[model samples]
Target: MKSWGLLLVAALALSGSYAVDRNNFKTCDQSGFCKRLRGFKPEKSEYSLNLDTVLVHGNVLSAEVDTVDTTAQERKVLWHYAMRLSALVDGTFRVEIDEVDPLYPRYRTQLALDGEPKADGLKLLSNENGKLTLMNSQGHKVVIRATPLKIEFLNKAGDVAVVLNDNAQLVVEPLRVKKERIDDEDGNAVEVVSPLLCLYCFCDWILKCRQVFVFSALTAT
Candidate 1:
C-alpha cells in the first residue's frame, strides 16, 4: 500500500509540472511598458537633470529630472521625475527615480529589503562644470552629471566600474485610470485624461536587483 501511494504522488507531481503552458505568458513586445522601453532608440537622451534644483539633505542628494518632448515643432517638458542618490554604509550606493506628481499611485515592491539600509558619510569632492562628485570613507566615488542625468561609480583607481542611464533607456510610465475610447462629431477618437487623484513613488524589485549588481561590480573592481 505504501509503495502504491508513493507512485500516485509522483504521478500527480509530474502532471502538475506539465500543466504549465509557456505560450500563455505575455512577451516583451506585448507589454506596453516593456515595448516602449525596448523600442526607444534616440540619438541623445531626452531626459536631463535640473542642476539648479539639486538639493542635499543629510546623506541624500536629490534633483528634479525632466524629459523633453521634441515630437512637436517646439520642444517642451513632457514629464517630470524625482531622482534620489544615497551613499550607504559599506561603500555601497543607491539610486532611485520616480514620477514627480503622478496622476495615480504606481506599484512599489516592499519585500525587496530586509530593512532600511544604513547610510554612510558622503564628502563632496567637487560641484562644477555640470558635474557633481562625491566620495565615501572607503575611497569609492559617485559622479553625477547634470545634462542627461547620469551616475557613475568609480573605484579607488578612478576607473568607472558601473553606470546608470547610460543608454538613455530610462522610462517611467505615468499611471492613470483606463478610460474607454469615444467617437466625436468628426468621427475621430477623442482622448480623455483622468483627473489627478494621488501621487506616489515606484521602486520595483528589478531596480533593487540592479542596485545589488552595481554594488557587486563596484566592489569587485
Candidate 2:
C-alpha cells in the first residue's frame, strides 16, 4: 500500500531522530497482499478504469475501480470500488479509495490529517491523455494513472514521492461478510486483504518494538 511510503516520508519529514527497529518489520514479501501484488509481473495490472463512472466536482474527481478474474469460471461476483481524489486549495492533495457499497463496512484509516489543506498553490489540470494531474506551486504533484490503476505522487524535483502501484502492487480489499456456511473459507481467505489492515500491522510492529526496546534498555541500565 502507498501508506508504507507515506509512513517513511512522514517519519523523514516530521522528525528523523527516532531510532527504527527494522527487525520488527516484515520484508514486503511477508505480507500476503504484498506477495500477491509483487507476483503480478511488471506490465500486467489486473485493474482498469470505467470512464463512464467518472465524476468531477470542482477540485475533486472520482471514478469506479475494477479488477479481473476467477477460476472455475461459473461463479460470477464482481468486486465494487470507488476512488476519490481531491486537491485542496492549500497546495495539498488527498486520495480515498473504498468499496462503493460494502456488504460489510470496511476499515477506514483513523490517521488524522492536519486539518483542511490550505487553499493555495493547488491546480487541477487535466492532460491530453485524460489523466488528472494536481500541481502544487511548492513542488508536489499527484498524477492519476488510469490504466492498470497506478497513482503517483511526485516531489517538486519531479522524483516520485509515493506511488500506489509502483510494482503493480495496488491490491484492493473489498468489504466482505463472514459466511456461516461451509466451503466458503477458501474464497474468503483470498478476498479480504485490506490496506488498512496492512497499515495496522506495520504500526503495531513499530510500536511494540519500540516499547520492548525501551523497556530492555531501562532494565539493563
Candidate 3:
C-alpha cells in the first residue's frame, strides 16, 4: 500500500508540473503587428529604396533607406527610416527597423536573442544590381535584394526556409511626444499597461501554483 501511494504521488506531481495552458501564450495571429506583416504581399509594395548608402563595419552594415509610397492614397506619406543590417559573428543576419528620429526609441528586448547560434560561415559573394548574394563556406547561398529590401535564406538544395520582408509590410512608426491632459471629463488619469509587468504577473502565478502542488505532494509523501 505504501509503495502504491508513493507511485501515485510521483505520477500526479509529474503530470501537474507538465500541465500548462498553451492557449495562454500569444501567437503570431494574436499579435496585431505580426498578423499585418505576415499577410503582406510583395506585389502591393509601393515603396522602394536605393542602395547608395551602404556602410560595412566589421560584420555589420548600416544603410540609408528612401521609401516612396506609390499607392495613390498613400503617396503623400513618403518617409525615410534608418536600417541596420548586421551579420552577427555567428553568421545569423540581424535586421532592425526604427524611425529616423523618434521622440523615444522603441523597446527591443535582448532576451529575444538569448543564445548564440552555430557559426554558418557566411561570405559575401557579390553586391550588384541592388542585390547582395552571400555564400556560406559550406556553399549555402543567401540572396538579399534591396529595392523593397527582401531577404531569403536558402539551403544548398535551393530550398527556402525563412524569408524576411519579402512582402514589404515592414512599418515602423516614429514615436511622438504628446502634451495632452491625463484626466478629462471624469477626472481620472488614463491607465497605462506594461508588457514586462504582465509577464512578471503571469510568471508569479505559475510559480505560486507549482509551489502549492509541490507542498501537497510532500504532505502526501
The 10-residue segment with the lowest total lDDT in model 2: 212-221
Models ranked on lDDT:
1, 2, 3
Estimate, for each residue in 64-93, the C-alpha lDDT of model 2 and write its tens digit: 977655332553335667776665554446
C-alpha positional error of residue 12 in candidate 3 after TM-score superposition, expressed in Å = 34
Worst 10 residues of 3 by lDDT: 212-221
Best by lDDT: 1
lDDT of each: 0.70, 0.54, 0.53
TM-score of 3: 0.51
Model 1 per-residue lDDT tens digits across residues 1-221: 99999999999999999999979999997765566556565543367888888887767778898887746567688888887787788677777667787665554544666887788777788889999998886788888887766778898888897777766655555555655578999999987766542332122224542222226326644
Collision count of model 1: 0
What C-alpha lDDT, on a 0 to 100 scale, does residue 175 get in candidate 1?
52
lDDT of 1 at 111: 62
Give candidate 3 misplaced runs (Cα > 4 Å). Answer: 1-47, 72-77, 89-91, 111-122, 136-138, 178-221
Worst 10 residues of 1 by lDDT: 197-206
Please list the Cα RMSD from the true structure of every candidate, rounded to 1 decimal place: 8.0, 16.4, 14.2
